[model samples]
Target: MTARFHTLGLGAFGLGALALSACASQGGEAPRMAQADEGEIVLMIGLDGLRADFIDLYDAPNLQALAARGVRAEAMIPVMPSVTFVNFYSLATGLYPESHGLVTNAPYDREFDTVFENGVSTQEERWWGGEPIWITAERQGVRSGVMFWVGSETQIDGQHASDWSVYEHEKPYDERVETVLSWFDRPASEQPRFAAVYFDRVDTVAHREGPEHPLVAEAVADVDARVGALVAGLEARGLLERTNIIVVSDHGMTEIDPDNAIALDTIIDFDTVFVPEMEGRGGAGHRPFAMVYGEPDAIDAAYAALDGAHEHMRVWRRGETPEDYHFNHETRGPDLFVLADTGWSLTAPSLWSRGYPPYPGVHGYDNHHPDMAATFVAAGPMFENGVTVPAFENVNVHAVIACGLGIEPAETEADPATVERLTGGRCPAP
Candidate 1:
């Protein structure tokens, strides 16, 4: 029977038609789609700003059940300066922030000497340049699906996923789960070989009320219900055994003390700095931190002032950045990167001058902080059941997914140890 594809919109854009055409032109011998022999379907659900400890605070039947049955990591180390856009790209491209070129939510473009706000509209060119796993899967005729991933809205390699949804504001969790189940309902020949679903409300609300807030717990439970629905859908359709399910998050969040705010105007002149967008509440990237842009001489002066003025902060030039951060070297980030010490945050005068209200929660800190450590859980044939692997880079997820679908990874930055474990230590380096 010929395969059929469909999309169920939840007040957002769909990519079914675009993906189908893109998949057809990428000509290569189609890899064998995983059949029931695969023993499980691969479902990767991303919960934004989900700290690993949030799991213990909330009663997540679905996630807890997965952990009880399969393996759960003690903590998943995110890429350096663990912001959402950077880590998400890391997850997709399996490359460090520097290698992938998306170093921060608002990166400085050295050539333009300006700040580029890494938003949904600008992600196509400003935020991402490396080959993501979905693009690689499509090249091999392995159908893939995406729902609100960081770079999903953008086209890659002249193609996008065979199924996808644009990033949008929070929607009902049940609707999100239903959309994912619908993709799997398609005939086996047409169903996505790999799929990603994103749940942002947890992160959104958590950022406002802190990870321990009642609202945050409520949001997690809501997400759990959605996971239960998706899992049930897979079982009812007999796709459970043939699918692999992965649950993860970007970075965690921490509460910000208004008293601890570091006014940038206090350290540098406002006119000399260029902030792309700073008044749109959460839309603007500055929070828990700030990016300073200036001429080389001016940058040097500002760096010096910040060094003595703010003892709680650390600053570095883009090229001299720490190897652990792995930031893009090519002039994409600011001339200098500033990280506020814990309990302290950098705030812009524009926020107050423009009459925008303040936010209560923020991320964009060193990935090593416990608050920045995300979570990862996988259950399927590609992963060893009830096995907990050591902490590794989130970038390895892309290679693991590619191996599961039997496709060539687009890059080789994935850790050899992680790759071997994901492929059952059988698939050789590509």
Candidate 2:
């Protein structure tokens, strides 16, 4: 087999130049696996938007086996604005969105004058903050294969991962599994000590059909099959015994009533606010919470209009969001925040002159909501077998992974006791 590498950037792909540089090993060839001293491999498998209860609600033998053999957290508490990119970054860096600088899936950074849309600003390394797990492993002289982690595409601090794939959600799940396996099947010294893989169809299905739909049961089975394949492959390569396999989702899903939409224009007079960035009518990515930006006086007017006008949603000025959310970023934050209750969505009434939006499910509600809780399943030597732990914050995961790799995790916003609980006291660090 040949070393393969391809990077999709700006024009056709939303990836950027730094991403191309990230795969510089692609001089018509892919980045070859690098040397690492540790035999403890960490394989992070991400099943996006898999609700905590869905594990038992759906038939998932593979996930059940993993839990039977490893630690299964009661639930994984997500950060404020419990959305994909925010909690994913929090899981990767052991920091809250405020510390990681990606307060939202798509944040507007005033300092760089850049807006962080998925395909647009994702490749801009300047927008990323703190040390992601891949960068952490790389800094410690270990190779990392980031098949498709959320924050893995940039050239941070002048360095990139040992190997990676450009973001492609439509890519088949089998292909994703095969690519990650290729990294592990290598000679022991050349294997990456850390790797991450993602599957989006579960989350996608829930978006279109809602989390309770029977189709989601099928999606659950499909991911279970992927897990089965991963386990089989690792065992075939004789790497399973030494590998630390962890399964986690950034956030979970909640059923949203399509008719239960809170029209932004009706709640807050759109005329008082500017267009474009100002109006995010409770869509999926911008939902349970949507940011509002406008001139100071105009924002004041908008907030007053929204204060008691709606029953299903709550609104707050940017800096004044509930202390629990840690959402107050001076520059990247919007002028005001509007959060919808679970099972409800925010929509742009002006844009909806035609009809209501077609989303049947949504996330991004308060992280404490049971529907917002994610998944955390692990099996390996790094954890005690057949045990269950109470729910903990996602911020503590970075330290746990670092502990498994036997490396010192960088200091961040995580509390030591919280991280210790995630590890079951197996690996301790300050």
Candidate 3:
């Protein structure tokens, strides 16, 4: 509604974005625990690195069935530099990366000197500048659960969710689904009215095997099966009719050829700027993008040095970045953004002097690139049946979930009209 998407592409989305799949079924004011007798529930399931087109390409009947009955975005547009931590937080807070202060993963926050890493950075609430749904839900007198959603492990607003789980990357999919479903088995008062679970195997495996590899397909099926399990478990508990399911992937996957590596050492003036985390993974330079930090004079010189150094990589200065990017935070945003072209790696040659172990998959490209588009689907009493809504930004997800929970969303940049349509006007625009 408020400038929904600057660039709408039929590229990776193909004809599916245009087709209409209509279903006729109606229900009450959806997902509002404030009113329902059985206490309607809302489940937010996050699947990492699942391309918007993967469901159609691979065998994912369970997700397809849900979409056949509910709302599916043509593709979910992630905020700029479309990486994991940034977009997931954007989805949770309804803010761009700049507004949320998580411009990129593992940056040197000038004020705090903290690099946003999974283990070290997640504990500090200062790194995150917005209110996540669980915290907002709790404040509004509703119980919420989080099974390892980003920022869930930390005390966002002075407390954890009513129920929460620590992250275990190798945890089995069925176990995670069971963990989410198990929350419902609690007594009516103890159960979470809203909940979230994250799965990363697809993104992990794809990073190694690329999007087309059979292993990625296997991962997709594994996630699809978990969706089936969650649905069945809810039905067995007679909560299926009351639960609204919203599924999303942080960002899509794109394959990077080993030869596509763009060595920053060749272009960047090392004295002028340095990457914050140069010790981990042997300093691979954060793959596909790097946030460079330096003094003003140094940043100016470094920007001049790297300008037009390569055709494959693009350099965006703090103030001169594209409007759609919404980049440029004082502390979290870098002096310069060195973004590799889609399917290329932004790395320093020194780290891989030994050998380049191929990582066929990567993201964090330009947000509007079709390959970077993520997936979105919602099926429940609160959503319209059988529809493919126009593509919208993931930021709107925060408000939509808040609306389903019947709570006022925190201050965010989500377009009210976008959230209204996605939630079938359960929380309409003022």
Candidate 4:
């Protein structure tokens, strides 16, 4: 396997220098598709913000049953900048955020000199770089479908799923399942071999009510019920035997005290460094984490200005970042990353002026943090029954699904053993 990460000046830069070269390769020999007898349809469902322990915390009989029947990982670790878009794209492409280019939910891309926001940015295809599994499936002569996934709505590598829809959140969960069921109703030749569905209610509610809030439990139940409905619908159509149900989450949420906000003004002087004001948009990155893109020459001064500025926030220079997080994107990312301590947040002065309260729950913390671990479970024909795997990165999810579909995975940072364990050595050629 080719080395995907290139670390430069590790010892010379110490813990503060940025150590990234460029995005990883976008090509590799596609995996050999599985034979008809070995091929298994995969349906990956992303339950946003569902923690690894939420299944046990809430009364989710359907999820518990799914875990009992098939394999459930103790936890699924999210990639760095443990936010929605980064990890979701990671799960889709089997690449880290550095490789996929959806580094954060909102990020400033210097290449295009554009700030990628939620709605306006998603439509731009250049923002998405990696080859998602949908495209990989198409390459191997297999059909794929997606309902409201990160990259599914836009074309990646000049192609997207054979069947897909623009993301619609207001639609009820059951209606979405019915839409998926409609796809299954197609003749065997036209049915999708691999599909994906995304559910955000749990994450939405959790962010408002906190993960431990009663509303979060209710949201978990609602999603579990939705999962049950999907399974039941498949069973009614006699598709359960052939389809593998892979349930996962983008990233877990953590409760934050509204009063524990760290104002950026208190940390660094805006006059000394380049304040991250992009086209009148002043806020840096999302809360719980903030990225500061400053004058290249003033980086040391900027680093010194914010270093130990707040006890709750840690400042990382370009090369000083942890190699494990893979967030050293000097070109695409900020020069300095100010990560709020878990359970805390970094806010802008404008928020206080406008009286915007801190969010009850948030993510985007270091992926290794305990509170950021997401869930993973697999059941049906392809996965081993009643087996449990150790914690693995969400990037491996695409590989697991690719293995089930019997197609070569695109270039990924996931471990090969994860795909092996998830498929129980049933996966075909790599």
**Best candidate per lDDT, number?**
3
Q: How high is the lDDT of residue 429 in model 1?
A: 41
Which candidate ranks first by TM-score, i.e. highest? 3
lDDT value, candidate 1, whole model: 0.69
TM-score of 3: 0.89
TM-score against native, each model: 0.85, 0.87, 0.89, 0.88
Ranking by lDDT: 3, 4, 2, 1
lDDT digits (tens) for residues 87-178 of candidate 3: 88888878887777878766568887756677867887878777888887788767899988888888986888998877888787778888
Per-residue error (Å), model 3, residue 232: 0.5
Candidate 4, 1-430: lDDT as tens digits: 1228311111221221222222221223222222334346789888999999999999999999998989999999998899888888889988876677876776777767667766667877878877888888788777898999998878775687889987777988988888887786665566787888999998999888888999899999999999999888777665677678999998899998867877786656666554333123534323777767757767777788779887888988765677777756545667888888898877666433244455688898889887899999899877888999999888777777766665666777767666677777764224
Mind giving the per-residue lDDT tens digits that candidate 2 earns over 1-430?
1111111111211111111112112223433432232356688999999988788999899999999999998999999888888888888887777677888887876676656767756777877888898898788776899877888887789877899877997798888889987876555556687888888878989988899899999999999899889988777665677678999998888987677777776666676664333333333222466777778899888888878777988888876777767756656777888888898777665654345456777888988999999999999977889889988888878877877776666666666665566566654433
Per-residue error for 112 in candidate 2, Å, reads 3.4
Segments in model 2 whose C-alpha atoms lie over 4 Å from true places: 1-38, 274-286, 353-356
Q: Residue 128, candidate 3: how far off, in angstroms?
A: 1.7
| lDDT (tens digit, per residue) of candidate 1 on 1-430 | 1111111121111122112211211123332333433322457888888788787889888888877766677778898767887888778878776776776765656765555554544545545677777887778777788888878877875688888776666566777778877776555557787888888878889877776789999988888777788877777665676677888888878777777767766777656655433433344333655656667778777777777577777877656666677774566655667788765777776446454545567777887888887988777665666777666668778877766665656754676566676545644442
The true-versus-predicted C-alpha distance at residue 57 of model 2, in Å, is 0.4
Clash pairs for candidate 3: 69-386
Runs in model 3 lying further than 4 Å from the true structure: 1-36, 277-282, 351-356
Which RMSD values do the candidates have, in order?
Answer: 9.0, 9.4, 8.0, 9.9
Model 4 root mean square deviation, Cα atoms: 9.9
